[model samples]
Target: MVNKPQKTKLSSVISLSHSESTRIFEKKSDLEVWSAFDKGDEMAFNYIYRGFTPIMFSFGIQITNNVDLVKDCIQNIFIDLRRKRGALSEVISIKSYLLKILQRELFRSIKKESIHSIQNIELPESAFLIEVSHETKVIQLESETEINTQLKMALNQLTARQRQAIVLLYEEGMSYREIAEVLEFNEVKSARKLVYRAIESLKQILKN
Candidate 1:
């Protein structure tokens, strides 16, 4: 289990590990991409789509626990983003904006699914991890699989928001400012606070 200080230190590591010098994409900023897209640059739109889709996919799968549903929701999200581009407000960080949209789309799908089902449908924690690990274990051993399963169970014990925080802060390697923007926090400090709280909860949950 990662302690508060250790997790806080890990957060810094997570934030800094990604090299700012590396060119992950040619485009500089979302606003720049948006401008090019507005000018009818299909390639610019494609670039944005490619950059954001994986994050959206992971987030969607986590919240909804339905692969097809996640695909549908993400498609719809891009459609909506395109449709609302003319009225798109100033966003501090494009990553955060995309995350917020993905979360909204995921929740909407969940609500719809709930209404359609007469009985409550409970999705296990780290459902996306299950999908990814399935193929990995096929090439590996049973003991490793068991350990991975237990780790996923540990992750499942976290609250929904905490899970989200941990994923964004650790797995996705987003900065506190970016997470703050995604979560609609007034400041980055609040975002850090959320992550710290989530980490503490996860440590306690995993320790037991």
Candidate 2:
């Protein structure tokens, strides 16, 4: 008689399929992942939410120091994305697009909670904080403390918009067009000019 073949369990097969799908989604490019999400792929949505939630939280906290507000805004944007995924347009950079949404949401929440009659909600220079990393300190070595102090002081002298522009350009590695979209600038040149002026100001401050 021929030997009988062993059959795989349905549960094991399903688990393996899910694991493989997750791995594939993780490796996909942003555009591909986004397109998958737009098509109502649950795995693609999970990949996007897991990948970007931390980044969105960090960016939101910089806009305003309120932790709860940032958390709520992040949650709300993800929910909105899920609800409107089919209607969403294709974006060149997913990071920049999500960030722009979070920034606007945070600002709107802040304005609603403010008691003062404010025409425009301009964030105080103190509101956007940039902390130096421990790795950067180790790299600087001998003059770390003094240099960190001076660098922070230099940053403090910049306007809120300038500081934000510098961070988006250097830390986030976004293009001028992306930065313009995030900051609501009319043109890409405006974003370019903002970064240029910010760098020049930093150099001048460091020189002194």
Candidate 3:
């Protein structure tokens, strides 16, 4: 039951425009759906949860190892949202909006438990822990068990903020502006720097 990142970008300089175009359309549609859901559309609300719960779950786990707590926080947020329906503001990106809300809620829960976050970043938790899929093609050369262990160890070494940056930028495919909104960074430049530094740090650590 290893759930990891999915639908990674296929390298193709030729189709870059088409890919970006498709992405933009999808983002626009998601925003529209969210707007409808905000206005008391039950079907639209369910649609959002069905599509994003898994991704949100993955993101939540990076913040804390308590799977049950993460699940509760997710459901709780939606329950609160449902209660506050029709008052919700227009959102540019549903994923970013949801992540921002979820992050705030998760941080509150983590604080009650008195957990220490990595690098003392704002609202930080311990090293962002992750579970890699054994099926990842890049690690196919190594035995599954060995590769999985290595991947987890490497991820565990990263600060919480770095891991959050990696998950948002890569796994969720968020733009820097969207990431800044979700992570509450002061500027988009800070989000970009965080992602770049995280990648460089991962490359160095994983090469060992």
Candidate 4:
């Protein structure tokens, strides 16, 4: 059986990294840091937690407006990581892996909360929200104002899954295979199709 770290120990492990360790791990690749972490290196764990927390929280908040719930879910995943580090699999992109875990954990927590609360909760299928910013590098248009208005409209027309696929592809810089893994698509082709459909829809909308 895999031994999980106790809460107190986990907290200490996550919180107590030295400056030298941070400097050392900062120069290491994700795989190296992750390998060290899996081997029970607290410094690597701290490095990961500190590095990824902002982006993870940003991704989580886009899925749902519940700030407290997003924070809680982020906290829980790190705890789970520390608890199950020994059983963790090899990871290529730590960002993609953590985002994938966060997405799953957010949905799972939302479902559980919905069951116990009297108020109806927004399901994962419809909950994803994104604001297409002025500096968006993926979609280029002839005019700035035209870009913002039309792009926002086009994005709004997309299903939650498609919008998410686009963000993961463009905004997060994930490969099709990574997207498939994160979105739970059975194959990379599914991820490709999703992004293709989404882009085609955007083009058609913008052209009109």
Output the number of the TM-score-best candidate: 4
Candidate 4 stretches with Cα past 4 Å from truth are 1-11, 17-22, 116-126, 140-142
Error of 2 at 27 (Å): 3.8
Clashes of 4: 0
Query: Each candidate's TM vs. the true structure?
Result: 0.65, 0.82, 0.69, 0.84
Candidate number that wins on TM-score, 2 or 3: 2
Best by lDDT: 4
* lDDT tens readout by residue for model 4, 14-105: 67765757898988887888998998888888888888899899888888889999888888888778778788899877888898889888
- Candidate closer to the true structure by TM-score (higher is better), 1 or 3: 3
Q: By summed lDDT, which 10 consecutive residues of candidate 1 come out lowest? A: 13-22
Candidate 2 per-residue C-alpha lDDT over 2-59 given as tens digits, one digit per residue, 9 for 90 to 100: 1122112212322334555678776777788889888887677766776787888888
Off by over 4 Å in 3: 1-28, 113-127, 131-155, 203-208
The residue-by-residue lDDT of candidate 3 on 65-183, one tens digit each, is 78998988887777667667788888887889888888888877777666665433354457455556755432334566786888778876888788777767766779999999998
The alpha-carbon lDDT assigned to residue 51 of candidate 3 equals 64
* Each model's lDDT: 0.63, 0.76, 0.71, 0.80
RMSD of each: 13.2, 10.1, 11.1, 4.0
The candidate, 1 or 3, that scores higher on lDDT is: 3
